[model samples]
Target: MVSDGANNTMAFPRETVLKVASLARLQLTPEEVDLFATQLGATLDYVARLDELDVSNVEPMVHAIELTNVLRDDVLVPSLPRHDAVANAPKTDGKYFLVPAILES
Candidate 1:
């Protein structure tokens, strides 16, 4: 267990820490596990404290600043021909670019 500045405490068990580390594909040393257990406990405690705030009158907002769609009007534009587009390609099979196979059978 660890305490946040607001007096709230949260338990960060070793099993839970190990599970999180495994899910994230991380390799943590025993020393790192102990360090993260305390850190994650305090973080969870701080987040738990947010539940005590009054938000009944608050409106849901997607972002802190006001936002509006700023997209440009859709319009047809000139484009390079397929041959021109492939001109700079390192390897091309006339109509498409080719690359080395990336996977093993």
Candidate 2:
């Protein structure tokens, strides 16, 4: 395990990477395993840097910035006539739109 002296976080091993890939149902080449091991290790090291910060006084917040809904007010509207709604469709049975079957038995 490769470790930076400043933090206790250890670099992810090839075995760990392979295990995670298996759990995630990924089929990775040998080169990809090594690449992912390095990348994942770097990501952990970067995140470990956060432990050095002084967040004791910082208050927890749901979002970094204030968020407000930008949606318009909801109001009841008249529905379009069935014929007009299906007029431009490639295939329709007057009451419902026809679509190709997407599932096989």
Candidate 3:
């Protein structure tokens, strides 16, 4: 059973699980459907318990912890010469690697 957030609990029906599976394009067996119905019901009950918590004094933020950029400064670096870069390629035209055409007109 799942809570209604008003001290009321209700069963999470199998029909709801089937409908969710259909909407998600999932093909679930009868056993799986029953399992999901129970699991989802428990999850909803947990969320309802969380809803009872008092968070009025808590500040709303995008994340639980402050985030700062951790990326290193970009620096230009020397790269492998073009000929050496394509030397190990299966097919090359000396200037560029040749790949099979994936599309045709």
Candidate 4:
């Protein structure tokens, strides 16, 4: 496991990046491979700097604001009627509405 505090002293290898791409089923060209190698390498370097922090007294916050499930009463509220729903539709058959075919058999 990576701790919140780690030194930015280690190098992330290209082999690890290739292995991870394989796991993700990504087909990377040589150019993309080299590009991602640099980007992922820089990202790992930034992640390593977090290791120097002493978070012993700091609370681990999941979000900047309080997160609590607020339940609401299940009650029927005013809603749009069927006529209003189809009011602006381009075309409709008296008892039903028609739409463009989504698929061909």
Which candidate number has the best TM-score? 1
Per-candidate clashes come to 0, 0, 0, 2
Error of 1 at 9 (Å): 5.8
Regarding TM-score, does 2 or 3 come out ahead? 2
> In angstroms, how far off is 38's CA in candidate 3?
1.2
TM-scores of the candidates in the order shown? 0.47, 0.43, 0.42, 0.46
Using TM-score as the measure, name the better of candidate 2 and candidate 4: 4
For residue 39, give model 2's deviation from the true position in Å. Answer: 2.0
* Candidate 3 local distance difference test against the native: 0.78
Clashing residue pairs in candidate 2, if any? none
Worst 10 residues of 1 by lDDT: 1-10
lDDT of each structure? 0.80, 0.81, 0.78, 0.71
The C-alpha stretches of model 4 lying farther than 4 A from their native spots are 1-10, 22-25, 72-105
Report the C-alpha lDDT of model 4 over 1-105, residue by residue, as the tens digit: 543223322254567767888999988887776666666666776686888998899988898887799788999998978787777777876445788887997
Order of the predicted models by TM-score, top scorer first: 1, 4, 2, 3
**Where does the lowest 10-residue lDDT sum fall in candidate 3?**
2-11
Question: Which prediction has more favorable TM-score, 3 or 4?
Answer: 4
lDDT of 4 at 60: 86
Give the per-residue lDDT digits (tens) of candidate 1, residues 26-97: 999999887777777778766787799899999889888878987887998889999999989999987999
lDDT of 1 at 21: 93
